[model samples]
Target chain A: MRKNNLKGWLYLLPAMLFLGAFMVYPLIDVFVYSFEEGYNFASQTYFDIGFYNFSYVLHDTYFLQALKNTFLMVVITVPVSTGIALLISVGLSAVKPLRNLFQTIYFLPYVTNTLAVGLVFMILFKKTAYSDGLVNLLIHWFGGASVDFIEGPYWAKMFVMCFYIIWVVMPFKILLLTSAIASVDRNYYNAARVDGTSAFRIFRKITLPMISPTIFYLVITGFIGAFKEYSDAVALFGTDLNAAGMNTIVGYVYDMLYGDSGGYPSYASAAAIILFVIVLTITCINLLISRKLTRGFS
Target chain B: MNTSSQTNYEQISKTSARQKRAVHVLVYTGLALWAVMVLFPFYWMLLTSVKSYSAYNGERFPRFYTLSPTLQNYADAFTTVPLGRYLLNTLIFTAATTALMMLVIILAAFAFARLKFKGRNAVFTLFLSLMMIPNELVVITNFATITNLSLRNTFTGLILPSVTSVFYIYLLKENFAQVPDTLYYAAKVDGTSDLKYLFKVMAPICKPTLVTIGILKIIECWNAYVWPRLITDDENYYLVSNGIQEIRENGFGRENIPAMMAAVVVISVPLLALFLLFRDKIMTGVSRSGTKG
Candidate 1:
């Protein structure tokens, strides 16, 4: 037993060290650093600012807008993406032939470079001087006026980003939910059918109840993911993450820390901490709510 | 009376069969539509990559298909940017990070799964809780640490922070735990050392999960845009994703769009091939990770 314990410790040492240095240390350092005001990255100089940094970030128009945009993304994306995924998985579960082919097609989006595809969408949605782009061409084919997608109003940009998130995230959710739907006992369906249960009723009661846990899982994780939206925004709008009026919190923080306009690492740290707190609070709330749903299932 | 009842049963069966066929048709149509929607952007990307330069940015309306297709854009992609070099860097980073992650995760997972250790459960629980903390929160301090260590622009800076994945460790641990204890002791009775047992018996038993994690990690590295962008200042160290982003941002003219698209296409092709070949494993791996979370 003693020898086994020693061996285990030896095995765990590297991982502990790595996580300690990278994760635990950074977490504490950032929390501490978030309190400093006007801290210079080069000079490594700072004075204790208490909650002033948080207050400043809260009051700042850009940061507040970013906070709102991030929340909007989470609110709009989680349900829309998860809902679409649920519907698709239901359709997919009914089919047997060419199922894998369709899945592979859908999953290609998840595997493709998000930034690269965001760039493609950027170009596809752009309205050129000579002609509306591909999307517009299709609209024109139907005798409808072209809609400005990228350079349009704030809500239009938000719509585009939300559309991108939904499209990209649908595959994973569908994959999960399809498997979830598949794993539910076949006998239940047989029993329901024997009683002459209508198809929609069978799905609504049996299928939905059985797959409620998976849906809950998707919603919670999807909510957390939306808050961290950064690269897609960058890919679509370049460094000009601001379009119309929307900017993601992560993108705003990135500009502060790494953008060419010089960085205030300390302020960025505070913003990140704020983002962290928001994520934590939301996760806790989700867990609290999900406990009720999962308990009923159990 | 019996013959009439039999005819009624036959009529009901025939109607139900027709209904089933109708249901199948609806399912297929819906899936097909979504699949087309999913594939349309990729098709457009490929189409745009091959369009003649004039068609790409001409005064004429955007054409869906070009009368003439050319590889000039692909050629320009290579010429204008060190795409091949960026690809090589990304490949190196992917391989290196995946190898390091596997080595660390395997050993740690084996320890957590099989070994009798003090505070083992406590340590494992701590790691699990760490997973809840979004990585974005730590990027600030991590950036500072890397800069302080003077690791910026180096592959070590890119690989080191991400070398040990807590999630992969947990997945492998779950896989390792499923291995029966009797086999492990039997190997011990046969004079197998712990490391030998792990390599010879444990690893093979968990081969599928390991492969899944390996592929996912590779894809993660391939799609990695943020950390690589932050760490590497020099173009030589730029990963393919960020490299294309930089080109799209910095390239001066509207005419460069095709070349940029070509670059995106080149970077994306290998991943598409990988996905096609290992579709089942990738999907299973993802779903497994999701449920575990």
Candidate 2:
């Protein structure tokens, strides 16, 4: 028994070491660094300012904008993408022909690098004052004034970001919800059909209730993902978050840590911890709210 | 009475057929619209990449298709910067990260799944909770740690922090637990060491999940953008993601949209092809991960 314990520990040693040094240590370091004010990276030293760092971050206008942007992304993208994905998956489940092909097609964005796809979107939405770009071309056809999506005002940039997120996230949710829908028994549909129920009623009353678990899953995971939105910002708006005034929570942290010619690790670390707390709190609330829904079926 | 019932049945069947046809139209229309939305960007990428500089900047609104096409942008993309080298670095980083990540995950997952050691549940729960902590939270200190170790601008710096994913460990643990405990004991009774049995028995049984993890990890590493950008400052260490972003940053000032699109096209094609080829594995793996989580 002792020998077995020793062997098991030995097997876990490498991974444990890696996690300890990287994850656990950094986690603690970030917490500590969050409290250190004016911790000059060059000098490798700092004085602890108690809760002042947190207060500073809380009062900072840019940080508040980032927090609001983060919330905006989560609030808008989650429901929009999840609802669209649910619709798409339902439509997909109804069609028998070329279903796999369609699923694969839908999944293209999920596999493609976000930065690459975001770049593609950047090109699609690039400034075309003459309505030359693809999006602008569409805008022109509708007699809508051309707006420079990437370089436009804050709302335009956020609009572009939300659209990009929906495009990227819709695929995975579609895939997930499709399988969840597929797992529902076909007999329920047959019963509903025999009762002369309308198709819309069948979907709302039967199909949706059956797939609520998956819907809940998507919402929870979607919120988590939206909270961590990063690379797309970098890809869409370039590295200058201040120029765009569209800094996301993670993007704000990232720019703080890396954007400056000199480092602002302390502020960045504090912002990161704040972001982490917000995510954790929201996720816990999600779990709590979803408990009643998920508990119904399973 | 029989004639009336038959007439009613025929009427019902005919209406049902019409309804079915309507449903088909709805399904196809919705699917087609979404397919167009999904594919439009790629089409846009290709279209923009092939447009000639004169046409791109000429006194005409850009349309979907170009009457004349040129490969000049692709040529310029290769020539303008070290895109080729960046792609190579990305490939190296992805492969190394995947392999090393898999090794770490398999070991840790197996230990968590089958071993009856002390603190097993506690340790497993700890790892599971670790997944809740967003990676961005830790990246700052990780950057400091990497810089401290003088691993900056190296593949190690990029790979080390991300080597062991808590999520993958949880996934493979779930997969590993599904293997019958009897087999593990049977192997043990037959004098197989735990490591030997892990490789010979558990790993083989979990091949599909392993492949799933491997594929997902590859895609993760491939799509990784932020960390690699943070760690590497040298042109030599740039991955395809940050490299393309950097190219876009530098390119557009010269009105090099075509070249940037060409670079985007080149970087995107391989994954698109991979998805086409391994559609089932990728889909199954992804859905499996989702459901299991």
Candidate 3:
């Protein structure tokens, strides 16, 4: 047993060292840095230490904007995208012909580069001197005024952001849910039909309950994913996200560290800690809700 | 009375069949519409990439189909910016990171899954808990550490922090544990080394899971943006993700939309091809991770 223990640790050594340097140490360092007041990056010095960094980050307008944007994104995108994906998955479960073709089409966005997709979306939505863009042209055809989805009003930009997020994320949810629905026992549905149960009621009572666990799983993961949405915003609005009024919490940390308003390590660490807290609190709440919901279904 | 009841049964069956047909049509229509919404962007991308710069700019309203197709933008994508270099850099990063991560995770998973060790479960639990710390927190200090080490703009810096994934290690451990212990014992009794047993027996048994992890890791490294963007400001070190962004901002400029789209198409095609070829493996990997989480 002693010899085996030594051998086991030898196997784990490389991974342990890498994780110690990159993951564990950074976590501790970030936590400590968050409390250091007005730390200088170049000098590697700080005069004082307290919650002052936290206070500054919490009060900063850019951080506030980032917080608001992240919250709205979380609130809007999570439920809307999951619902849309569920509908599509359920529809997909019922279809027979060309199902594989449709599934393949839906999954395309999952593998494509986010920035590349963002550029395509930018071209599709941005109104330029030469054209009104395809989306605005469509609006014009429908007798609605052209709305500049990119570089436009707050609501319009938010709409575009949420729409883009939904489009990108729905494929995975659809894949998972479609399989979840397919795995459900066929006997229950047949019994329900024999008793003359309506399709809607059958869905509500049987199908929903059977797949409730997967639904709850999607919601929890969706919330977490949306909270950490920096790249998507960067892809859409460029790296100067604060100026675009669409910066996420993660983006705020990056900006503080390495943007036009850069070189504020203390402030960045504090903002990162705040993001960590928010995500943790929400995850806890989601876990609680899912526990109750799943138990109720069972 | 029997005849009347039979006729009634026939009438009911006919109505139900018609209703089922209606539902099928509705489902297909809905799926088709959503599919279009899902696919239209790719269509638009391919369309815009082929249109001439002059033709693209001259349009008063965007045309869904281009009358004259040109490969000029693709040529421009390569020449105007070193997109070929970005692709090469991305390939190097993805291959190095995935290969190194696979080796590290496999060894660690073998330890946890098969080896008898003091504090093994406790250590595995600790590793699992590390996943709870969001990547954002870790990334901040990693940036500082990489900079302090003066390893910026090098492949070593780009590949180091990404070479160990706790989630993948956990996944592989579960898979490794599923192999029957008899084979392991038989090999051990024959005086085969642990390393040899791992390569010869354990790995081949878990080949599908291994492939899935490799494919997923490649996709991740290819799509990685934030860390690469932070670490490498030098154009020579940029991955396709950030390289394309650089092209958009500086190389191509915003005015050259067709050229920009062409750049994007070049970057997106490789992974698209990979996914198409290994569709089942990727889907199973994704769905497995989703449910297990």
Candidate 4:
């Protein structure tokens, strides 16, 4: 038995090696490269301790916009999607025959390739002076003027962007919350019923608390996922071949590396390192906070 | 709990039947509306994909069966985009990466679940916390790593960074914990190696979870766009999603939107079909993942 147990450890070694080569190695290299003066793809010469790389990214206007946009995206998306999905999922708990079917429908968007979804939106949203898309079609139905959704930073752009993310995200949340809502003992509901408590009250006191842990779980992950998304920027917004300044932080990193490095991408690497630190730090904080909040239940 | 709840719940249920009926109606209405919103875009994409240029330019929605619908867009899509190459690349990437991730997750999950080593909770917590870090930073550093490794345009480079799925480990580890240490003891008694026991015993018990994670990894790998685009500058290395973008970029002027949509529809259909085929497993996988989301 001991021999076999050791064998299991050995089997796991190959995977560990791959992780070391790919994940651990690169992660360390990011720091090393970031601290270096400059890296030329042509020569691969990395020399100098230019904190200037980090300083430049820190001072860049577009980088700040990307950071702002990315943060706003996470803050707005996580709670909103989780809250709405929780509502829909709670509603779904009592309905059996329709539950799985509807849940599947909601989850469809989540599973679909975001690339196609983004492209589809671009075509659907295409509105010039004379043309109309789906939203415009609806507005016309209401006897209203057609509006270009992606152009102006009106309620329309925010609305479309939010709507797109919410659609993609809601399914995952609904599916997750459905299980959490189901986890609550039916006895609690019965007890409340025996006490003549209203359905809403039972939900507030029992259902909400029971599902708080799951809610926290979705929020942090959702924030991370939504924040990193640059598909909409690249696919839906502009035509720089890589969707230029609708730049999310990740998009900005991409722009720096692939777009115009001027033969030296060390600055982008520095920016990337800072981003890694930020994400690592923020994620750790989020986990600690979630743990603290749901210590008892989790 | 069931007995008392059954009695109290029955009383409340009997009294609230009418109210619950109203609630049911409202709930269904809300769900139906949401379902439409969630569902309509995909439907619209399909509908628009099939609509001919005349119909697309002319009508809001196709009304009759008499109108000519051609697979021309599908044809143009395939021809216009290196969709064949993209699909092949995506399939290969997803399959390879999924295989790799599943192997790592199953093993690491076992280690986390069964092995008694230091930093167990702390390490698990680190991986779980890794969940909260958006891919933005990782991807940027990943690009830098790729450039350094000189793996800039390779398949392995594309697949390497993404194969580390922390959440999958959490789910599998949680499932693995439920296997009752009795099994591990039995395996030990039989003198099976830890690796063999994992594959031979724990892996079988965790099969459902494994399958679920496998499907997810495949779907996720297939859907990968941002990193692939960043890492690979050429269309030769493009995955299906980014390839679609390449198609759009190169064929922008002459290709009609419907035809382009036809290309998208083609790109997406296989995955959608896969989703339908494994709908139950996928839902449960997603649901279970969500339980701790």
Q: After superposition, which runs of candidate 1 have C-alpha atoms over 4 Å from their true positions?
A: A293-298, B1-13, B252-254, B291-293
List the candidates' TM-scores in order.
Answer: 0.94, 0.94, 0.97, 0.86
Best by DockQ: 3
Tell me the docking grade of candidate 3: medium
Query: Against the correct fold, how does model 3 do in TM-score?
Result: 0.97
User: Candidates ranked by TM-score, best first?
Assistant: 3, 1, 2, 4
Q: Report the C-alpha lDDT of model 4 over A19-113, residue by residue, as the tens digit.
A: 56555555666666677776667777766786878988899888887787677767777878888898899889977778778977887886677
- Can you rank all candidates by DockQ, best first? 3, 1, 2, 4
In model 2, state the lDDT of residue B34: 95
Which number leads on TM-score?
Answer: 3
Per-residue lDDT of model 2, residues B18-85, tens digit only: 77998899789999999999998989889988988778877356676888889998888888778899
Each prediction's RMSD over C-alphas, in Å, is 2.8, 3.1, 2.7, 4.0
Model 2 lDDT per residue over A1-298, tens place: 8877876787788788988988888888898888888788879888766877788778988889889888998899999999899889999998899998898889998888888878888877878654457687788889998888888777888899999999988878999999999999987876666567888998988888888978887898898889888777778888887667878888888888886623888889888888878878988899888897667646
What is candidate 2's DockQ? 0.59
Best candidate, lDDT-wise?
Answer: 3
lDDT string for model 4 (B27-125, tens) is 999889998887777787777777777777775533423256667678777776677888889889988888888888888888888887544577567
True contacts kept of each: 0.74, 0.75, 0.82, 0.46
In model 3 chain A, where is the ten-residue run with the lowest total lDDT?
Answer: A189-198
> Which residue pairs show backbone clashes in model 4?
A1-B191, A4-B192, A4-B193, A4-B194, A5-B194, A8-B194, A8-B195, A217-B293, A218-B293
Chain B TM, cand. 1: 0.91
